[model samples]
Target chain A: MSNNEHVKVPANLMRRFADDPEQADLEVFGRRSDGDRRGFLRGAGLATMGAMLGAAIPFNRNMPAGFVPEALAQKAMTVDGKDGLTVLNDRPVNAETPPHLLDDDVTPTARHFIRNNGIPPENTSADGWSLTVDGLVNNPMTLSIADLKSKFEVVTERLVVECGGNGRAFFDPPAKGNQWSLGAVACSEWTGVRYSDVLKAAGVKDNVIYTAHVGADSHLSGKDGKLAISRGVPIEKAMNPHNLIAFAMNGKELHPMNGAPLRLVVPGWPGSCSQKWLKRVWLRDVVHDGPKMTGKAYRVPKYPVEAGQKVPKGDFEIIQAMPVKSLITTPQTGIKMSGRSMKVGGHAWAGDGKVSKVDVSIDFGATWQSADLSDPANPYAWQRFGAGITFPMAGYYEVWARATDSEGRSQPFGIAWNPKGYLNNSMHRISVYVS
Target chain B: MMQRLLPHLFVLVLLGAILLAPGRPAWADEDELGGIPRAPGAEETYYLCSACHSFRLVAQQGLSYESWKETLVWMIEEQDMSTPEPEERELITKYLAKFYGRDRLARKLAKQQ
Candidate 1:
């Protein structure tokens, strides 16, 4: 039999067989010999089967003897709290939004992508939760959610938070971590106190050069003391007033998966720098050498390396501001175009810079037409861009969107090869089936 | 008739108790091999790797033999995973490289170019 065609036995029958092998006929398991059936049961009992299922079989008791659960048969998996997301990994729960779902100006909370390195904290209650600012600070402070709202100035700003490995899946060799497509980015209205204000309140010492952020998320290894990931930003970036110690997303409380109660919104940088389930911020005299800080955790090669080439750790530098990138959110990919002229639009963003220009191509980058681009609502918020494209003749056409940053840098047609793929700002393209 | 009905009633009660259970069922704690393809060294690889993370994490990568070895070493040195025995390591690496090689579709596209 082919590897794909595995004979699936229901949980109840498997249990009965485990209890009495002689009474259970081997014919039910399809062409399996008596010895084979015994070995299979011994190796993979009901519990092993449960783990293989990825989730608990809630109605296993009512299932018929030969019934296969829909969960086991279905290939596509959806996350519980997420909508229209492509689940990359269910264990650590890394998911990305489909580009079409990201059409909203301010990405809805459900539509926001989830990029988790470790399991989120089980208990995320804000009532007694507190954020600690310590290490190289003259006045170390621990402020509760209530204290944070009352003591500091509360402000809301729309900001873009994108994963460093947003387009890692497009890499030729493929990246090591989550293979996020284009959807690991969102511009959400965040409500919180300015990070600089909180830092000043804590009295950052002169020796501080970097900030190390810690979260309540548990390590994937199930190890007690091990941290899943702890990344930080340079003190200068942390000191930016645009950075927020965010407590809410949009107008509502932050989603649990998006870091309920508290998180840091360090915009224009990798979302990893924006620590979620934030517990503490440690100011370091030297660069913060925390978990995922040193080596190539978020760092790319200091210089470009050939694809599949090995590079030493010292030759790597940490990624700061993300490159210019844009996405065509309208007329979702593979849509049937009803008319010759279509209003094409999307969002463009540049880390620590403004999107100066956006261009759309109907003939696959051979030629391009400029798209009308809107200025960002805030310094780190993504800018909206729109254009009306008239297809000369409707054959199968692809709409490609590319944005140029204030520095005149545009999205690359080819990927800049790195061992651990990060910062891939390739031009976004969508398919249009025009009759 | 009464005796037959008694057995059926007992089964109903047992099913009700199981269905009404508050948390995950008892079978949830079993060793999950993540339904990885059954191969020569698959069982060993699953046991060794799944101790730290799900086997799906291991299965996700399509790396060369050397890269897989490097990953194993990295796991031991950096990620706090205990070093496996030499034979076990070799078996696991070879199994991974064979099943999930660098011949992924994306890599193929690069090679064609």
Candidate 2:
């Protein structure tokens, strides 16, 4: 039995290199020029082999000014190897947890996807870190972690926070940003105070319609130089019962990678709204036009686009609640099996709605069977689904999971081709061999 | 057939070009390149973009010349990235469009299909 295994390189790199010489040129090895050569030798068969041997050389150990360090790339690959997380970028640390590894109802903090717009500040401690609530409020106050725990009723709830472009690789004509597979999402129990309670203490002004969130993570260049991605959610979303200013994840102090000290947990919205290492929450009269809010950052086309079509002018809308999506974490694709029957299970989530039903297909969507879905622990948490499958006679099979929300919206077979590849809730398929 | 062999043959031609080029170093490493195109003025282009984020992030997106121009404009306007003067912007645009542009991506995609 043969199964396509996930290689560490970008999804298209190996295939593209195999297809054309020009494709090889576009890859890491092909970008070399004579004048700027390093101290690593390679054979001519390197391109044909499609294995990046030169990538092993650690020449950027002490990268010069204005160059990204090689250590971050190495760490990105090694940091969460158990989850089979795929690295998309290193500086500012962006990686995706493979769908197969995200099988549990509550994702382990280590398995959660790491999507950072700026580098985590060195030596961030609860000592110096405090959250400031200001703008359109009668009382502006900066509160420490102790203030948050003492002043407000601390609550713990499970929630799903996913990148808007979770399954971007499925997009045809392929979009910009990280080419994330179905691993850019996770469900976790977040512990903190309700954001509304904090705002209430500050006395919300009537005209306030949005909350601009800012974090301590600074740019690799400099803070005074460029803004490190200040984004916001509408006042309505911020006022949701589940929205939190979380200080802990999975019952432990938040992992520095997950967001230490405090992070906003905006359940059922794009993870960007949940600013990690959060420090400031500014109430605003209008939508926050921060770095990512403008010019097609988290925005997508208002209507379905034909593949390869340029985005129409003024049709781009800011993505709010993500669409219904599911992933099969068990029986990871390409795992060879000897059993007649196997326990198949995974996790599913719907933004601003419940995952009403989840269906599993063993014959590549030819036939479908209902997977028993566990109830969501909270209104915003992802639900776990499981089903027993007995293969009559199987050489190779791909298990596909599709989810439908209570609103009757279901995951599409193919993602609508948006330019930025936002909201890719296509069916999550995993292949395995049953012998 | 030559169709099958053409890509392999093209690699050989590229190798020969590297071997024959002036001031060519004896070796090259992937870490040094970081996927940046080693075309003329790439250093200027790399540092210019690195002022905001990693060059690898920019290199990953294969865009059309127009899209690349628009990206620079987007960086300058939306991202608060410092704007380069007219002549410098032209040079950087040429370098980006030449290597990371749509034609190269389309060529690769056509072959893959």
- lDDT per prediction? 0.78, 0.74
Model 2 segments beyond 4 Å from truth? Answer: A1-76, A80-83, A220-225, A338-340, B1-31, B35-44, B80-113
* Candidate 1 wrong stretches, greater than 4 Å: A1-76, B1-31, B105-113
In terms of lDDT, the poorest run of 10 residues in model 1 chain A is: A25-34
Model 1 C-alpha lDDT per residue in residues B14-107, reported as the tens digit of each score: 5454444433333322223344444678778878877766565565566889889989988888787888889989999999898667774433
Show how many residue pairs clash in every candidate, following the order shown. Answer: 0, 0
lDDT of 2 by residue, B39-111 (tens): 7758678778876676656655667667778888977765667889888898888888787665555334432
lDDT measured at residue A357 in model 2 versus the true structure, 0 to 100: 97
lDDT of 2 by residue, A1-435 (tens): 101122223323433444553434434444332224322223322331133332222232222212222332233344632356766665667788877778777888888898888878675578878999999999999999999999999999999999888877666565777766678898989999999899899998999998898888876556474667889999888888799999988998887877788999998888999998998899999989887887778998888778888886588999999899988888677778898789888888899999999999888788999999988999999998999988888688887889999999988787677888788888877777889
Candidate 2, pairs of clashing residues: none
What does DockQ give for each predicted structure? Answer: 0.19, 0.14
- In candidate 1, clashing pairs total 0
